[model samples]
Target: MRGRIIVLKHNTPGLLRRIASLRRSRVLQYRDAKGVILLDILPQGQCINAARYCSTLDRLKEAIRRKRPGLLRRGVVL
Candidate 1:
């Protein structure tokens, strides 16, 4: 997997979310040759603990359902 580094002048929180929420805006996503599949963004200075990890997994499952409907029905390797 690759990591993305976002540079911001301000240190305040919620700025990223605001920009992402704009009309027709886009958020970082996990992609493969097929196309975008999942979006999982971790807030600045935040750690991925159990609760957050579980929720991320839930979001990933939902994304798969929408983006690649047949993926789950067939079978996913990982």
Candidate 2:
């Protein structure tokens, strides 16, 4: 399984709620020294499938779309 990193501009409460709601067993969180929070969405277990990866990306995209659409266009990844 591979990992997908998603970086957000700021850690907003609404964004946190969206992430918490969509977070799965494979989802992990981290923050850098600059206080930038990153969500590492990875496929679980030994096998990596498209559906899992796509779903994860879709969920995150939807959450971002609902909260901050500008981030999506401006490139959310760091």
**In TM-score terms, which candidate is top?**
1
Model 2, 1-78: lDDT tens per residue? Answer: 334444466665676556545545355554435543336545335344698667756766666666565767976444
Residue-level lDDT of model 1, residues 1-78, one tens digit each, is: 124334454434885556455434334566656865665555455677899878877888888888788878977636
State TM-scores per candidate: 0.57, 0.37
Which lDDT values do the candidates have, in the order given? Answer: 0.63, 0.55
Count of clashing residue pairs in every prediction: 0, 0
Q: How high a TM-score does candidate 1 get?
A: 0.57
lDDT of 2 at 2: 30
Off by over 4 Å in 2: 1-26, 30-48, 75-78
